[model samples]
Target: MKRLLFIIALFVVPAFALEIQNLRVVPKNIDAGNVTRIMFKLSGPAKLSINVKGLNGASVTSLISNVLYPAGQFSIPWKTPKKIESGYYIPVITAVDQISGESVTKQIETRTAKMISLPFTTSDLPGGNKEISYSIDKAALVSIRVGINNGPMYKIISNWELTQPGAYSVKWDGWDGDHVIKVDQLANYLIDIKYIPVEIDALYVTNPKNISKKTIVPASEILRQINAFVPKYSVAVSNKKIASNSKNNESINLDINVDDNTLEELGDIPYEYVLYIDGKRYGEIENTTSPYNWEISTKNLSKGSHVFTLMICTSIEQINTRSFKVTL
Candidate 1:
């Protein structure tokens, strides 16, 4: 009986083996507006099948069934849907060996794209001056149109034009035709512009007098607005606490927050940081005006109790600063 069983097993032995050599998504890094392709490679003579599913286990659109090929090497392509938001997606590839009745499966990961928007701002020009200046990057395609809140009358100061790709700049000059319009007398005019890669709309305008007395526009607010206009494809922005100056016996520790919003709206800005002693400008942090954060060291500062001041400007149109003091 043993000899007969051995003979039967030898005669029924499988003729081929199947294996999965590799499985990968063509573009590992995918953005918000692009599509990702998935490819698979196999070895041996086997029937293949593939299925792509999202994070929720719901199958991605267009991926239906496994494809059948005559063995050797084969590849399959799958496209990611555009409606999918920014996140991770997984796809499954399964293959079955016809001769050995064996099967294998693989899971692939894909990422979704990121979407970025623009920032808006409203502020007085300076010295309680009625004249208001609207400024944006020279690279960003920007156009300024002024109209009353409820009136049909409108004026186009800068028509929508692309002088460059990333940064753009335009000045209102606070005038209408030959007549120099007083800032307070002008109707609330709405301004609209498109900063490259992002669109900004419905930004309201108000006379400087309309603002609440207690409400003050912080320089950082403009920075945040500028960052919102930057294209999402370029860089990321975040706020964090950093050490200003740490050296020798005299050191000042302060919180510094930085982001990209300022660069997107204001164009290239010079770095500036203000130093304060006991809530006063020690030497006035100069050149700390860009969108990035400032963390300078005061190790060379004289020893004993001392306060430090730090200031940051948001836009080139207006110089805004914030101050913080610390004792050492």
Candidate 2:
């Protein structure tokens, strides 16, 4: 009888030595915006209990109740704290085996979420126009507001429009209440938009195209030779000296002097003169009569050198030339 009891004791002692096996955390690292899961298996047939302790001594009870299994294979999930202080957290999982009174523990370290920064800014569209756009780094919830300096707050032209998180565009037609914005008053306008942190590379406000001249010229026979220079060049001379008249305060004057030798080839039709500065078309003049002359004052031109182009054309052909040093 004593020998039989010794054999049973040996078997029982070995069963009590059961250990944890195949322990794994579903996701090794948890990002700031995500959840984590952990799982593990044990060796003996027994009822098991689990307890998890955080590094800071905060303990979370096992979501699963005492579970019966031949071999203790278990899984548990825990929600990470939302506002996690930046630091490492160690999780201790302890499993108690009911049958053999054996306990096994495992530990895992979890990293906290990180802070994010974004670059962003706001600016006006080109031509000092009323339109505006916002640029940001990533797509996310955005809040934008605009107001005159120290004035009452108002929604951006269309409330906070969800922009494509990167480069985005918005436009504001020149209007405040019942007042329409005068072209001259557009410069003093101010716009403000705010958004989450993002890197803003640049912002720009554009002004209207400052035209310097505008005029019309007649198609002539000799002028046809000039029109043959280039295909599109004809159109360049067709519309001469068309400018805004606001940028140039100078008088629009024209003089035409043709040599008698070239007059016959020029025929009854006179060479038409067209001028433009800075891509704007100025008016034109026809050299129908000898020493033809015309003059008008400019409005927007500042005292400086502006681009000037002269096109001489007839109905069939046209010739054009450009000079850059024309002073206002």
Candidate 3:
């Protein structure tokens, strides 16, 4: 009878309910150039999308577009913004059952931790009013002190000056302990930054070329109202082109003479490669192990095209993409 009860218990029961649980943001204090993973468990098959939003209700990166999946554990990886200002953010997870349409929304608070550190190496000449510049990733309370080379200790120039998130210079009118001094008296500079994370949602990250930027919140909405004493330049954007920073761009050469752009294979074991043309995903190269190659036809494309991207993805996390200006 005990054996019979044990066998009956072995026949497990499955949950019919559809929902996502145990959602979490790994290493909540994000850093520069790190991958942030969103993890969760599903009770049933569903479609889900994950996103990060600034505290001001502005949507950051849409990490995962809506996709269907089976009931299981999942951890989706996303490349965190390289120059994200230290602030409060939220990871939003939304899921919907494929059959029943039942859905659930979950959120977890995440933030960028702050630290006191030396500024990047700088050398500036002293004038009538000397300006000392520093580049910071976020808004910080700055304290500037100046000292002479082989002379006296550092003296306080400015204390607790709230500055914006970009590279701004602090001006010093050659003062020594609340008294006027000559510009030649200045020799060395010591600066310290104190970070206090903000609960802002909306901001823009712009690149130098303004191409491939990420906006946690749109600029128009965030600038609608300016509260009293808020740091004007607390948020910043970057101008990074997506094509130049790929690690898996190494390609194999081929002897064949073809007009179409040919893609190279992995190696002895031809790993499956997926291609993207004009920002849209095409099919994948099936299983095989050889010096395989493929090309895309540009005959049907418009003439004198300016800019587009050719990207290739593999099973690994690193992706390769090339941007070009074609005149066809």
Candidate 4:
């Protein structure tokens, strides 16, 4: 009869347990001057503290400190600091259940999507060839268009091409898409380059063991915010030295200038200029100084109406094209 005896065990679950839900960072990507919202929901009453931490487990910024709240939803706005490094950051939330004295923590990672640094450089090759190069911090869809300044795009070097992080070089033969004519001949050879970063999913790292794996965001996420972060530029030439008419054997000075507001916003960023006369390359220069001057002589040119195209590009590859017409 003793062999027939049985034993039973029972497990209980807490009815008022505290839990954090729907943790997220609104506008997951932002610049140093913008504000992003940190939002989450609470299942029960708890004492909460929120702060941002880097992947190296260092505190970046503190948002809240041991505040009591009823079970509901809450939001906190954090303004990115100018001194903050552009990279991945995590928002950590610590909660202590008021009834059960239980503690739980959650971390949702975010990224600073600002255009940090662009060290653009170019290399000249034989036979009037060029190697245009630049480096990027993150993966992006890059586009490079070629055309005359203030004219239609005649060639597409890259149309929203997916590129990885690193330096890349592109060869330019100075010709249109079909190689029918040199780009300089049509107008100022304008290389319009733009970059839009791929969207990265916010990682929710609740456990310490998974922190490393999740911190490195996968590059396969779908693209979002395509038009949100694109920068615009406007270019112009000074009329002080621009002449509407010139004799066939006379020399004329053309003063080129970019918008003052745009130059001021892009402080210390280097700029490159390429000038072209009707069907010919005139000159190309790189400098930080604005209102560059170019002296053109009509001594050897055919006496008639001519088109002058000027292309302006920043280190980050923001391009603006302007055209000037004159009769000789």
Could you say which candidate leads in TM-score? 4
Candidate 2: lDDT over CA atoms? 0.44
TM-score of each candidate structure, all chains considered together: 0.28, 0.26, 0.32, 0.40
- lDDT (Cα, tens digit) per residue for candidate 1, span 268-290: 54444444444334553454433
Rank by TM-score, descending? Answer: 4, 3, 1, 2
lDDT for model 4, please. 0.64
Off by over 4 Å in 4: 1-197, 200-232, 238-241, 244-249, 315-318
lDDT of each: 0.43, 0.44, 0.48, 0.64
Q: How well is each residue in 1-328 modelled by candidate 2, as lDDT tens digits?
A: 9999988988875435667766555564554335556576777765555554432345544544466666757666655554443222344545566775776666543221112232334456666555455566542224333333432222234322222334656555444321222222433334555432222111111112321111111212112323231112221121244333442446655444444544554555546765555435676776456545546455666777665444455554233343333456
Top-scoring candidate (lDDT): 4
lDDT of 3 by residue, 1-328 (tens): 9999989988966547677788776655545556666778988888888888764577877877689888999888767666765554567878898877878887753233333553643345556565666666664445454534432222355443434467766666665442423323544533333433323322223223333212233222233343312111110111122222222332211111111222222323223444433334444565632334444445445555433333233342112323344344
Segments of candidate 1 deviating more than 4 angstroms: 1-16, 62-64, 109-328
Q: Which pairs in model 4 have colliding backbones? A: 185-279
Error of 4 at 293 (Å): 3.1
Worst 10 residues of 3 by lDDT: 230-239
Q: Which residue window of length 10 is worst by lDDT in model 2?
A: 213-222
Q: Write the per-residue lDDT of candidate 4 for residues 1-328, one digit (tens) a residue.
A: 4434422222344477688988988877666557788889999999999988764467888888999989999888888776565555578899999888899898763233433333456677999987878877675556677786765444567645545567788898877654545775553656777665544344222222222211322221223222232334556666557863545448777777777887875566567887667645777787646766666777766778776766676554435555556677
